[model samples]
Target: MKAKTQRLYLVLGALVALGGAGALAFSTLGDKATYFYAPSDLAGKAAPVEAIRLGGMVEKGSLVKTGETVRFVVTDNVETRQVTYTGILPDLFREGQGVIAEGHIDPASGVFTAETVLAKHDEKYMPPEVAGAMRKVEGKVS
Candidate 1:
């Protein structure tokens, strides 16, 4: 092969290898990647037994507590989702504020069984993943 062609082949081969490696890594992680959805977005699409991140404002006067398990409803104006968490909630967690719960949903009941609950913080503060989620859904809802 000509020297120029040899170098071109080497570059193309490196690019192909890098692309394949990236595809493999992304595929492996895609299953484990958790996507956050607002209560409105979760409706009809949320599958019971499938773990996901649910985010919305805590409905006023709907938070209930029994022992370490806390039950609340998250709302995104258009819909509400019942969430149950068996862990300490953040001090900032309050009704009428944003919250994100992580857990599996009951396919039949549509209730979320949250293993972790994250509360919305200041305007300048929020989990990066959650922030990204909100950004993703921006303009997609009315």
Candidate 2:
């Protein structure tokens, strides 16, 4: 092959390799991604199958504890979602406070069975995801 033809083939091969690598990276990352949603966002839609983070305020008078399992309602003012966790909760977890629960919603019952529950550490601290979600809800209301 001529020198010019060899150079053309090399460039094409390099492009193909780069495209393949990009595709692989995106696919791997997509599987690991966990999406965030507020209670209102889930209204009127089927619960998702994959793991996700649900962010909202713990509704007052909605918490119920039974042995190691605890259940509560998370609300975005317009909608509510029930969350159940089977482990010790964070010290800051309380009613009328912000929380983010990581888990999957049960398709049969439409309840979120949380694997982990996170609460705001202090009066001035709120998770960015929860803050953003609350802002979105407020924008809709106003």
| Index of the highest-TM-score prediction | 2
Cα deviation at 130, candidate 2, in Å, is 1.3
lDDT of 2 at 104: 95
Prediction 2 TM-score vs. true = 0.84
Candidate 2, residue 16: Cα displacement in angstroms equals: 6.1
Q: How badly does each model clash, as a count of residue pairs?
A: 1, 0
**Candidate 2 residues 1-142, lDDT tens each?**
9999999999999999999999999999999999999999899899999999999999999999999999999998889999999999999999999999999999999999999999999999988998888899899999
**What is the TM-score of each predicted model, taking all chains together?**
0.76, 0.84
Residue 117 displacement (Å), model 1 = 1.4
- Note the Cα lDDT for every prediction shown: 0.79, 0.95
Badly placed stretches (over 4 Å) of model 1 are: 44-49, 123-142
